[model samples]
Target chain A: MGVVFETVVISFGILYRYNLFKREKERLAFELEINKTQTTLQLIATQEAERKRIAEDLHDALGGNLASIKMNIQNMAPGNTQLSTVVGLLDKASEDVRSISHNLMPPEFSETNLKDLLANYYNQLNNRGSVRFNFHTSGIDRRFNKIDELMIYRIVSELTNNILKHSHATEATIQLIYYEEYLEIMAEDNGVGIAPQISDGIGLKNIQSRVNYLGGKINIHSNSFGTTIIAMVNYKK
Target chain B: MGEKIQLVIADDHKLFIEGLQSILDNHPEVEIADIAENGKELLEIVRKKKPDVVLLDINMPVINGLEALKYLKREFGQIKVIMLSTYNEEHVVEKAKAQGANGYLLKNVNKADLIQTINLVHLGQSCFPYRLPAKQGLPGISDGFLEQSNITKREGEILQLIKTGLTNQQMSEQLHLSIYTVETHRKNIMQKLKLRNPAELMKFIISNNL
Candidate 1:
């Protein structure tokens, strides 16, 4: 009877220790998985930052010099007739180059207000200036964290570019408003709105991905009035 | 076509200044007298150069574009200033636009629009990249454009009358739209355009060439 009792006690102790070890192992595994995911995300973010910096450098430095050289070359033709023809050709070429440079990096993001940035961006793409751009904001002075600021900037800018390229919007409005705990950014356009299904354009996906990474809520609405995008991120101290 | 538009650039980034200089060096319509890297430089340039237009950046090393705007306006009454910024917050933008910028151009603006804006602004049109409601001296713009785009011709006329700096009731008396209707339209226009800050719309009207 004593031996049987001892055996039962021993078995229960062994089982309990085994279960404890298994639980700890599982917890560590989960932590490892989380750490790996975080590292991967950080790596991708760093790559994107480097890419943007390089693109900006090229646009500002290389693009400007090239435009100048091309213009000067067009002027160097000997005769008036030749100069006119060359200049005209050069003008087309320069415009094309400018467009390329514009796509490489959005220069307008540096502007102080969203109004001019969208207005300037849309106007450049729409030759006839048919798309009217409007922006309005009301609230206390709010400055977001650096990462949040950059993300918002990219989202608004990328959305505007998408509208210009795809939506055929004749007008766009961007609004920034602060609610209780979040900063909201709204971008809307008066153009052919998106259908129910979102496309696979890298731009849209990129935006969605970025918002997701930031743990922000993005709501997209499309109708006859046009497509409107609302993105909100919680303020982090 | 017009005299090279007198220009002042304010930014905190040295690289951006370099980039701008590279572009300005080749632009036919621009005459960049000097470039400042901060708000202080902007103020100093305003005193010395008194440029026809100042391209002010909102996020600066010191003081900021909004504050600089007040100073520039007080010191240089006739000079036109344009707010250049990265963030498109309407509140801050509206504030800058109202401060008497001749035009507001985005940084994403390409080489051509940059030149065109300066030329148009120099010619006395409030030059903006995209369309803005055309108002005369920002008078009724707050009520007319912001209130509603469904404005009847009479409402427009009345709004224009208001923009010449008229009182709401006075505008109501002028336009057949009941004083209530005029106020409603004004509110509607603002809502549709999402222009919550009338000062910003007013600023947009005053700064850019119409």
Candidate 2:
């Protein structure tokens, strides 16, 4: 009886130790994951800041100089063919700068709502006419935080870009359903679905990271017909 | 009636402002009151001088043109404000109009048009080159929507091309029409439908199954 009791106590000690070790391992893993996410979020913020700075420099500095040049050239010679040609080239360069800057950083989010922003972007895509894009939104009359809106915008852009590049899709639709606490983004396209191998590509990965950053989960449903992506992000005002 | 139009120009770009100043100096009917480098200074100058016209740049430091326009219109409603912007965006133009701007002119406005617009605004006339904002509310796409809207068959074809994301140049190449002709058709379609921009046009097309 004494030997049996001692053995039982020893066994309990071993089990407790094993449980403690397992908990420690899980804690370390959680810490590592958190550290990794922090680093990634910092990187994303830095990238956005850099992009914004570059866009501003291109728009204000280069754009202003180009406009001044055009104005000067026009003032110097109202209709001189040589000067007119130079002016035409200047206009083209200005347009290039504008587009590049706009792509780098869209117009101020404080100035326009997300729906208009998305609509404008889709309109631009439709101008390419490769795919017919439709955007529908409900319960988005109110605005979200700037960062949240920008992230959502990027997600949609990335998804559409993927479609434009690979999906061979003729029709695509992006729908935003806003609830009280969370926003659901559903992007669907009618084309050859994303292959399993291609699903691991950088585009989708970028989207995944963005969704993760937004504290959201993304589910991708792909088959021979097309692909549909749904991401739900919980947001705070 | 013989008074020279007193003008205060506000812009952040020194070179562009100088170029504009020289152009305006050539006009005998216009007189320079002062120049402000930003919207804040613009308001200050306008307060002191009470200029007849304020040529405000949309993008400026310290305070933006739109905000200053609001202040100017409220404090000194008599001072005519002409938005001198590099952007010809329809929304921006619409915002300016809604904010009580007397006129809207592109930064690259020619000497003749610039002078004409300023004079016209000073004389209590509103000048805007772009089409006015259409009525709010999307028209439902019924079966006879196109017919009711008077969209022509050629216009319909162009609309289809536009839906396919074809640029005017590409459509011209494919359809054997000049870019100008394609643009005309597009404009006519938008006017008939009373759609403001391509996005609305696309939305209408998709909703109507056109």
Candidate 3:
């Protein structure tokens, strides 16, 4: 009887230890997943910073050099046939460089308030392709914190990029409605609808994360006609 | 075009200044008197050259365009200043106008609009990008605009009267107020609407459908 009791106690101890180990392992796995997501987020932010730095370098260095070259070539005077052609080429190349750098880097946020940034982005989109862009703003003059502004800008830019890449549609509209307490953005594209079985891609996921970071909500409505994304955030938050 | 509009262009970007210089050099009615890299330099050149107009960029080293504009207005009120910029942020434009900038133009504007703006500024009329009707002056004194802009009820009444082509004297008579009070009201309306002069206020009244 004594031997049997001792064996039962040993068995209980083994079972208890196994369960504790299992629980700890599960907790560690969950933490690893969270850490992975956090790293991804940080990596993305760093990548954007890197892109901006590179873009600025390219613009300030290469673009400045190109402009100077063109100026020098033009300064050689109009009668020089060969130089004029080279000057013309340099001018075209400089313009291309400007466009590329602009695409790579964000606008000077300090210089432009939110409304101007949106209008400028819309104008750029309109210029880039056949898409007709209609940007409307109401009571959007008030400024927000820099982080909020940057996040909102990123959301808009990412959404627009998706539209330009995937939506073959010709017409799109972006609206910014500023309420007393909250700011809302609505972007609509008459593109091919999102597939029903399609999972959220990286772009959409990035937008979702940004909106979440801003303590906002985003709703995407898509059909055969097109897609519309509505996002709202409380400025106070 | 009687006397070509003499211009002093101020921009930090050397390439842009040169491009503008080349463009203006070809124009019959526009002459580039001098170019400055920044606002301080602009002031120095303006003091020497006394150009009829100064095309100023908003962002510059060693005193911004707006800062220089204030000084210029205080010292040399006769020289018309046009704010030329790549970005048309409405508030900045409004502030520039409030500082007595005669006009605003985008750098990307075609030669025709640029020339037209220069001429208009020279003629003592305010100018802005044609696409930006509201920035040139208040487009109209619409009820929505009044509410959005926080114009008082009395001010709204005055604005409406002004829109109807009522002179300050006529408004004083109609509203049963002193002419001095009416004049004060008119001045307040211009300040609130960011209109530089009576002509722009009139344009605003017509364009706004008010």
Ranking 1 against 3 by DockQ, winner: 1
lDDT of 2 by residue, B1-210 (tens): 348999999998998888787777657899888999998998879889889999999889999999999999999999999998766555677789999999998776666788899899999999997553332222343346675664444567788888899999999777655565566567657766778999999999898877
Candidate 1 at residue A180, lDDT?
51
lDDT (tens digit, per residue) of candidate 1 on B1-210? 346777888877665566567667756778788888788878887798778888877667678777888898888878877776543334445566677777776554555676777777777778644444432222344454433343333334644564587777887555433454445445534544356777864664465321
* Leading candidate by TM-score: 2
**Where is model 3 more than 4 Å wrong at Cα?**
A1-108, A123-129, A134-143, A177-184, A195-199, A232-237, B1-7, B13-35, B83-100, B103-128, B132-210
Candidate 2 per-residue lDDT over residues A1-237, each given as its tens digit: 999999999999999999999999999999999999888878887888888899878887888788887777677867789988888898888878877887787766557778877766676666656897766665544546776677888898889889998999998767676655778777767789887789899999999988988889987777666777878888765
Instruction: Name the candidate, 1 or 2, with the larger lDDT value.
Output: 2
Residue A63 shift from truth in candidate 3, angstroms: 6.1
Worst 10 residues of 3 chain A by lDDT: A67-76
TM-score to native of every candidate shown = 0.51, 0.72, 0.57
Q: What is the interface RMSD of each candidate, in Å?
A: 10.4, 10.9, 13.6
Model 3: residue B118 alpha-carbon error in angstroms: 5.0
The most accurate candidate by DockQ is 2
Model 1 bad stretches (over 4 Å): A1-30, A33-37, A108-130, A190-192, A196-201, B1-210
True contacts kept of each: 0.00, 0.20, 0.01
Task: Give the TM-score of chain A in candidate 3.
Answer: 0.72
